[model samples]
Target: MIPFLSAWPPSPANPTLPADELHVWVASLNRSQTQLNQFWQHLSEDERARANRFYFDHDREHYIVARGLLRQLLGNYLQLPAHLIAFAYGEHGKPELAAEQATSGVRFNISHAQGVALLAFSRNREVGVDIEQVRPLDDGEQIAERFFSENEVAVFTAVPPEQKPQAFFNCWTRKEAFIKVIGEGLSCPLDSFDVTLKPGEPADLLQVKGSREAAARWRLENLEPANGYAGAVIAEGREWQLRTWQWPA
Candidate 1:
């Protein structure tokens, strides 16, 4: 059987910022497409086909499951009808709300990689989340040199060779989370931003050009998604807290 993480109630010690504040949810899709068909049936044919175009079958299932979970969670959080929680994607494919909510000013973003998906929501602030499964690399250092900034490449290269893949994924997810929050796609150069993601340390903001002052309003966090993945979230404004819910089977 595919193991899944269930949403646990939050504790006072880990109190949510506010009912209306930012929250993050992570879901695992280790189920077969046939098992996920119940969720898939809710989408229009086009949406289902679009999701299916993803290279991996689990990617398709997780995307659909995450959207359904988002709709249900938004209904409870915003006290809006589930159908009213609409979505519209940006020119570069960043998803946003389609219609204004009665609550007003709520924003969210979603991302998935491997078998995991992440959703981030905030009140009066834009948010983005990204997760990547760390995979074995024959030459992770070489790939970092090709795609990462000179400073980032140097950092990875200095990682004693054994820990380079983890270091590379840490940096990649931070940069991707930030870029995803900016909604600029590849137009926002990766080299323009620098992120600090030293192993066992929290993600720190690094300066980047072309990101609006609005982008600076964001708070980014490195996430621990299950055992094999690295993840991060970028949200507008500081003084925010995150609550993660794992979707049930």
Candidate 2:
């Protein structure tokens, strides 16, 4: 099992990013006004403007904190001041470090929900991370049938009623992590791939529809960010080791 360590590094220096290691961080988005103000300093003007576009105050605060923390974390890895980090957007609105800033080939992805965020980092490999709070959905099964692959729908249908929520999120998070890894967003057909959703089972991308080779090229794993949350992370290759860390540790 992956362990989210509570130990903070002693120094503010750049952390090593090994080619064969993937780092995942769990962060709490809730912060006091003073702390939130400090995090705000890490944002770019564009990011700050985007934060302001959120409809809810809580959402706006969370976006600010999440973006700020992302910059801070990338700065640590990139050995630059947080404010100096630059980001560029992909065609699908996915964010990546500006070309010059990413010479080391460091790639990352972020996902957050309900005041918690998951950030993933890797060197020279694509990575995606997703976290969602486990909540009851009235149309959970219908959603499964509509989006999950045929095999996934069958498995999800067989899950006990009390366990459906967990199974639904397991499938959702894994599928989302895959899309993020590919940077294709919703245009990637959900039913075109398959992922394991049963609780207590190992998370895996069992098939990628037509390409067995594509399915073998990536690795997927389950994440338990917090008590009421379900998460998953996928990376380009199966060789890297995963390390989990807690923010503000």
Candidate 3:
């Protein structure tokens, strides 16, 4: 089983954990081309064609590899058979285990960007995660003005031009993570909440207006995914700890 520590590595004021203990893994989907092709070869012709139709080669490869890694990590940590870990989807396409499995108490969230994917697991809390690549933006300010709350727009407008993309992505991921946590999708207005995501810092909940119960019940974390990506995770409850793990290629 994965090691469980008595306490998490302090807080933002304290140093982050060693890279290894952060439980962050990175895979170069580019490097997995051969393994992906082999996986395809094993599938029936119809299944292969279905994958081709539903996903790009890279996304298909990512799904296959990520699911395998999630199973491996879950099995190692929970001692549960990987095959028995059934999956169900939320109204918004957020994938989760069935009520029976969920009540039995395993929770996880997964997100992928570029060639890398992330998986987070917890035994006693609801979790959700999102990752996005930092891309050049032609009109980030306009987009923020259109979709962000007044306070969020103020924060975005104040960021230096060079830092705007990262700031934008950071906010986007945090919002997505929170939405996913509630399984509410776009039903939650993007402008109704605000998250603080300073560089090299943990995410802080700034403002949440609609559901008082939700705001009080969930904890959100912003992650620095490598150097070029922004990521976030939201977990229900306050007593849980986060432990990131890396996957061996």
Candidate 4:
């Protein structure tokens, strides 16, 4: 299990992110209206436009908090003001620092579920993070059949009934993290790769269907960001250390 450090200073400071270390920050999306107003200013015009596209106020608020916090966090690392930081997207819409900021060698990915969000950052390598609030699912098997590789489906089917929810999410998060890091999005089928999903089993990228040596190029680590949540982080290469931190630090 990964441990999250809650020792954050109230004011921003330059944090060292070594090339061989990965940082994952956990934050709560729920914020007071005042705090929301402050965070809203951190977003770019394009981001605010995207947030406005959300029909529901709850979703719009969450989007504001997530993107705002993301800018603040990246701002600390880049030593730049949050509002001036720009972003560029990949062919599949995976966001990354603009070329100007990319020179800093910071690569990142973000995911949020329920009221929590996870942001992962690494230097000189791709990184992705995912968090999901565990909940009962009536269609777990049906969804697994549609998305899981053959080996994954068989193992998932044999899990004890009571452990199914956790197992399902464990698999879901790990796979999502992998695809996001690869920047292929769903264009890379979830069923085209395999991951370890058994409760208590170590998180891993087991195989990539056509690439004999692909699985060895990345590493997966399980995360428990908060109660009732399952999270995972993946990054290129296995030589790095994971430093988990809470937001507001």
Quick one: best lDDT, which candidate? 4
What's the lDDT for residue 116 in model 1?
A: 72
lDDT at residue 162 of model 2 (Cα atoms): 93
Quote each prediction's TM-score. 0.81, 0.94, 0.77, 0.93
Q: Which portions of model 4 miss their true places by more than 4 Å?
A: 1-13, 210-212
lDDT of candidate 1 over 1-249, digit per residue (tens): 323333333322322336346777766656666646655655555666788789976566677776665665666666766545667778998877666663456677777776677777777777777888877688776777676777777767777655666777888888888888889999987777667756777786666664446446767788876677788888767777677766554
lDDT of 4 by residue, 1-249 (tens): 223333421332467788988988888888889989999999988889999999999899999999998898898888899998899999999999997898999988899998788989999999988999888899999999999999999999999999999999999999999999999988999999999999899999999985648998999999988778899999999999988777652
Worst 10 residues of 1 by lDDT: 7-16
Model 3 segments beyond 4 Å from truth?
1-28, 31-34, 37-50, 210-214
Tell me the whole-model lDDT of each prediction, alpha carbons only.
Answer: 0.69, 0.88, 0.66, 0.89
lDDT of candidate model 3 versus the reference: 0.66
TM-score of 1: 0.81
Residues 1-249, candidate 3: write the lDDT tens digits: 122222323223222322122233344344456666544444444444656674466677766666655655555544566544556787888866675666646667777878777677666566778888888789877888888878888888888878888888988888888887778889989899878754555686666884556476777776654557788887767665556534434
Question: How close to the true structure is residue 155 of candidate 3, measured as C-alpha lDDT?
Answer: 80
Question: Comparing candidate 2 with candidate 4, which one achieves the higher lDDT?
Answer: 4
Where is the poorest 10-residue window by lDDT in model 2? 1-10
Tens-digit lDDT track of model 2 for 1-249: 123333422333446889999998888888889879988999988888998899999999999888888988988898889999988888998888897987878899999988888999999999999998889899998898899999999999999999999999999999999999999888899999999999999999988976878899999989987777899999998999988777763
